[model samples]
Structures are given as structure tokens and as C-alpha cells.
Target: MKASLETLEQHFATVIAANELSHAYLFVGATNSGKMTLAQWIAQRLFCTNVKDGQPCGECAECRRIEEGNNPDYLVIQRATRTIGVDEIRGLKQELSKSGLEGRQRVFVIQDADKMTPAAANSLLKFLEEPASQVVIILTTTRLARILPTIQSRLQIVTLQSPTLATREQAIQQLGVDSTFSHVLSTTQFSLEDIQGWLEQVDAVQLQQTFWRWLTQILARKDSAFTLVQTQILSTFKEQKLQQLLPDLLLAALSDLFTVKFALNRPLNWTNQQENLQQFANQFSTQQVTALLEIVLGLRSMQEANVSFQNVLEYTTLRLLVVLA
Candidate 1:
């Protein structure tokens, strides 16, 4: 559904028109890049009773049921926890072994396929090895490296591009947030679901402004910057509230600042805050900004590894101070 996936859509149309649909496919892309949406569209196309020009007619009963998640022939498997267990893969194999309930073909979509446990991934590899005649398997993931190589070898991998700023703005508006907040969120590589969850907990506009103010203080070598980190970032927000997301927001802002400072040709993610970014960019040397960006980026991996958020923030502040000095 994302505007950025036009090329991918055309490719699928061509494949269907040629009657060359693959048995197994891997959809790899950044989060919120429409991998799942494209997978669903492909499933609809395969299941639609009224297909026109290699695309689903959308008005067909089968297409409507698929859209409503009530299609008997279409199955979606997702991780209920941090990892997909081996049992889930076994269950999928069982489902695939049976005949299609309503249609001639069966489609299975596995979301976050990279989150499969090693055993689960091995099991999936075995399943993928034996192709069913009337079945299609589509796996979607933001982290392609985590998937097994044997499994990857069996799939026809399709890479997806990130959505444009304008497309993201429209999505944000539809989520019931002010469109201006997209200026802050669009800079970061977050999925639509991730953005919606964050917005539900806090005002994204205010959070963006607060991060900008904190970064400005750090750039100016103000003692209050550390104070803000301790009080606002660490003490006030708590780990559950802002730990993982704050680092990403900071990184996004710093990246924009670095681009502005170097007069890069790429578009700024925070277009609405151009004046503040320009001012901040003027205060830092290229080396200092680059160092800070690297530090912030590392924080993302650390956060994922279950590092202490407070320690990470304090260390980040110290590192920024050292870079600025």
C-alpha cells in the first residue's frame, strides 16, 4: 500500500502475468517499508476469484475475506513473543500438509520471520525444502541477517525501499496524529506500528522538541545538558517509557544536524525544524557531529541487547561532551 513500493508491485504483476510465481519468497526491507502490506497484496492476487491483469479485483468475495483476515485459504503466522518457537513452525507444516479449505491454493505469511528461534528456523528450512504443489510461503523481516542461510537459499528474496516523507506524512495523519509530527518521526527508521505505539504514550512533537533542546545544550557545552539527561531523560521518562525510542530519536536528529552542517544534498528528516537545526549545525565541527552520531547509533544496538538504559544515557552524555570538547 505504500507509494514507495510501486516498482515491487509492478514486478509482482509481471511475475503473475507470466505465470512464474515462486513457491517461497522472502520480503526484506526496513521497518514500515510495506513488506507485510505487499505480502498481503500478493496473497490476495493469488486467492482472488476474479483476477484481472494479474492483480486482484478487490471487489471479489475472496479478496474481501482476505482483507478482513477471514480467508480460510490464507494463513498469517506471527511471533507472539520475542521469538517464534519451534512449535509454531511445526503447526505451520501441519497446516500446509492439508488441502486448501476454500480455494485451489493456500498462502502463508510469516511476519518477523527473522525472529524465529534457531530450532524453529531449522524446522522452517525443512518445510521450505519440500515445496507443496498448491501452496505459497511468504516471509517478511526487517533483519535479514538473522534468518538462516539454508532458508535464505530456498527463497526468492525481494528487497523493498523505504517510504517517502510525503507518504509517511499521509500515514501519520491517518493515524490521527497531527501531520507536523511526521517531521520528527519520518527521520527515524520506525514502522507504522512502532510510531503509533510511541504516539499513544507521549506527544511526539514535544518529545522531538525536547530532544532538540537537549542536543543544543550539549553542543553549547552547557552544564545543564547533563542535568536534563538525569532529570528529564533518565529520572522522568523511565526505561519503559522512553529508553529504546529516545536513543533513536536522538540519532535521527543528530543525523539531520550533521547533514545540514555538511550541506548534504539529501533531504532533512525534520524539515519543520530547519531553523533550529541550522543554528545547532553552526555550533559543531564536522568531526564532533560525526562522533556523536556514531555514539548514538551504537546505543541502538546496546538497547537491543538489554543494556542498562541509565548507564547508556550517561555514557552517551560523557562521550558527547568529550567529542564537543
Candidate 2:
């Protein structure tokens, strides 16, 4: 089940009711921040024949078709490869030129739109300038700063923050995570997918062992031998699933180190590995912790750049070792 995007959903429904909706929208936010979910809800609201208050009547034939991916007027543009090229944008323009097959409105959603090539972005800009009467284009991007300036100026920008702690906790329960395990995985913010994923991947006993082993290797090794450990853990699971947990693992590790360094009295979750955490804390200053975060983020960016996961992992491990030393 998807987490609700209640506020943005209401706003979009209001705009549709007012008939003052902009021709284009740029959804700017971090990964898994509800941008795509909001876009779909907006699309359903725009096409729903009977709206009850602010939500679509999921019983309607139109809403059903849209959910089933059978709606003729609704199109979702995702990268067929690493980037959206000029031909894809050109094809969309051709599709838009035709009359709307559906009576109400035609919606096109471009997922990861920041991956649009320069020529494709220019093509999209032309469409935004003289948009079709009943057509709406929605662009979703994690890297809003990288979006074309001309394209940015033409569209209404919606910034979605990470979900609150309470919302994330609710999601953890909704995802059927064991109640006993909630406190450990409950801190993720504004991210439904990550919580859901953790709930799936985690086994309290196994997780404790793996986390301790990983932390131990990082602290004990001098020449970054833990690169092999990183590979082994990541390989034992699905790549996407493992990647989803990286941020949480890193954040937890960092927070523990930070607490010890600052002499804060926060309770330690890593009591079993307290010695290593404290050792790392004493070895690296705040700047080094910040740099390690950048290295982790840099690895993700490289994956976005279409670099192989092996290459990214190798480079990241080497950088992390050097920084730690």
C-alpha cells in the first residue's frame, strides 16, 4: 500500500476544480519523497468523473482504468535507457498534437526528468511555452538544481519534504514490521519506500550481527579490506534493496559516532559494537564524518551517472578508507 499524499492531493484537486491548473508542473524533491505518488493522485483527480470531497471515488470506471494503466489519455514517460533523448520528446509532441482521446484531460508524467538530454529538454520547453488547451505535463526530479533553467521558469515548482517522524512510524506499522523492531527502524523521515523496504529486509537477530561485523571490519582494517565485506553483503541481497538501506546504515553509524564525539548522553544502539564506534569517533573528527557522507552520496551519484555498481563500490570503499585513515 502507498502512503497518502494528502496535502498535495487536496491542492491539486482544488486546482482542477478551479480550472486554473498550470499546463506544467515540476515536482522537486529527494528520492522516494512522494513526488510520483502526488502526480498520480493529481492525474486521477483530473480525470475522475465523480470526486468525493477532495479524493477520487476509486469505484468509478475512469479511476479504475487509470489505476490499471488502461487510460488512453494518461501517459507516463520513464527513461527507456540512461537518458530521455530528443526522439522520445518528439514522439510525445506528436502524441499531444492529436485531439484528446479521453473527454476530460490528458496527463503526461515524466519520471526522473532531470535525465532529459539537452536537445530533449529544449523540445519539452517548446511544448511548455505553447501548451495544449487540455494537456498537462508533470516532471519529477530528485536533482532539481540540474534541471534546465528555461524549463524551470515555465513550470510551477512543488517541493516535497521528507515525511515527518510520526508519519514514518505509522508507515512502519502499516508495512507489517514487527512491533518490537519499530524503535530501531522508526527514524526514517518522509520516505515510505525505505521504511517498507527495511521492514522487509530486516531480521532483528541477523541485522545486529551484520551491522556489528560491518562496523568491526571498518574500524579494524588499515588498507580498506572491508571493500570485500561491502560487496559480500550487497551481493547476498538484491542490489536495489541493499542500496535502499545504505543511507539508514550510514546515518545510524554517523549518529552514534557524533554522539560519542560531542559527549552527548544519547543511549547507544550499538552497545555491542560500542568499542569500535568509540574508536572511530576518536580517530576521525567531524569533518571526516562529513566527508564520509559525501563519499557515500558520491557513490549514489555515480550510479545515477550510469556507472557500474562494482566500479562505484570500489571507488567509494577506497575513498572511505583513505578518509578514515
Candidate 3:
């Protein structure tokens, strides 16, 4: 069953209240799915001197210090790049060796724990095996498969679920996205964190519209789809951003097309372009749409493997054109 963030928080609070806290916790979920936020919340409760009814008083000095990153008892380890190295883990180990200077409990949160190098992960494993008393270790990762099995076996794993539709809609609205784009985003499997990241991009709406128009043209077998890739898409966005967002936009559009073809009353990513999507959907067989959707979904893994963004876009355009032909 799916649990909301509040439910998970309350469960953790109860665990803390009972003094049944685990030595280590592994939070696994999609990026921006509140893993880090929950980690911080737990940290606040752990450090708070004014805990009441299984919850931390947010106005407490301990809570404020943790929030401001000024708490010596609370340490956060994160890398700016792809991998967290041995030196970083070693530094954390050294810090963990010490006792909490200010707060009653020491809490260490490692963000993107799957990005740790093998040696770094092993170092962490050693530390977890001999964890300090009164210290709480929280590790978070979007890519759970990449974490070492030995380390995974040592911690309590918390898998966060995507929020319910109502919660997601409220979040999207608060992000200042208009009803149209908000409806499109809230319908997808995207988490609140994912929506927030998209909104941070200045060209997010343009990118979505561009991908929609390109898909429509490709289904119509128009040469402008290929032209748009070369002149507009490739030139408009950086390679990294293009590689990330393009596949997602395409997949969402494909889902909308599938829904439109089947006359499903589901929400769509391109809500304002429903008529256009219906027209596009009518031109393709269900099997054809399904096949194209698979192709687009496969692009995500390719992008993860450092495949060329420009080549992927060109190849996708060519493949879709062939499929339509």
C-alpha cells in the first residue's frame, strides 16, 4: 500500500519516541521524492531538546541549528560530481569518531549514496558495522541498484512512494505552474521533486511544446520534425539538459497519445493540445504507438550511459519517421 510522506514521518517519530531507532537507514526512491527532506526531518527530531508527542518542536534551538546547517552534531556528506570518493567518506568517518558536541544525538546524512566509489562504500560499510552509540546514519539514493549489497544488508530500507494525485496537484499548483501545465505534470508518474526541478528550468514550457509539435510532425511524416531537431532543439538547450528532458517529454506525450486513442478520461501531459493529440493518435495503430513508446522509454537508459544527446535525438527522429512510414 502507498503511504504519504506524513504517514512515513509519523512512523519514524514513533520509532524515535520508543528509542527503537535503527543504526542506519537507506532511503530509496526517485529523485525529489522527499528522501532528503525526510532524512533532515529525522535529524531534527533526533537533535531536538524539546521533543513532544513523538515530534520535534520546530522552533527549538536544535531544530534551527540543523535547519541552518550550523549544528556540529549534524553532518551532511554530498559530492558536487558523479562519485563520492574515499577521502570524503574517510573524512566523515573521522568526524563520526567524535561525540556530539552540542546536541544529545549525532546524525549523519549522505546524499546520493549510490554515487560512492567502491572503496568509499566499503569505508562506509566498516563504519556502519561499528556505528557509534547515539549516532544515526541516513543514506539516500535514487539508484538503489548501484549501492553495494553488503551495505544494503546492514540498514533499514525505506522505499518512498509517489504522492497521491490530489497531493501532486496541490504541489504543482503551488509551484506557480498554470492549470494546463500543472494538469499535464500531475497526471504523469513524476514526483513533487521532479515537478520542482522542471519548473526551475526557464525553458521548460517551451521544451514541452517543442517536443509535442515535433511528435505531431513526425507522425504526420513531415520533414520539419527533423529540421526542428537540428535547428531548434539541438541549438536551444545544452546537451545535458536536452538528454535529460527530451526523453521524459517524449514519453509523456506518447502516454497522452495512447490515452487519447483509447478515449480514456485520464489526465494528459499536453492538456491544452488535446485536439491535436487526438488527431495525431488517429493516424497510428495502437501497436505502432506502443512500439514507439518503448523506443522513447529506452532512451532514458541510453542517456544514463553517457550516449550522445544529439545522435539520440536524430536517431529517434529517424526511427519514428520510419515507424510512421
Report residue 50 deviation for candidate 3 (angstroms): 2.6
169-201 in candidate 2: lDDT tens per residue? 566667765543354466633255655555566
- What ordering of candidates by lDDT runs from best to worst? 3, 1, 2
* Global local distance difference test of model 1: 0.79
**Residue range with the least summed lDDT across 10 consecutive positions in model 3:** 236-245
> TM-score, each model?
0.79, 0.75, 0.82
Candidate lDDT values, in order: 0.79, 0.72, 0.80
lDDT of 3 at 227: 82
Q: Over the stretch 32-146, how does candidate 3's per-residue lDDT look in tens digits?
A: 5688789889988887889888788989988898889998888888765657999999899988988888647788999889879899999889889988888999998877888
Q: State model 3's lDDT.
A: 0.80
Clashing pairs in 2: 162-190, 163-190
RMSD of each: 3.9, 4.6, 3.3
| Candidate 1 per-residue C-alpha lDDT over 22-103 given as tens digits, one digit per residue, 9 for 90 to 100 | 8999998877788888988988888888888777999888889989999878899976466789998999999999889874
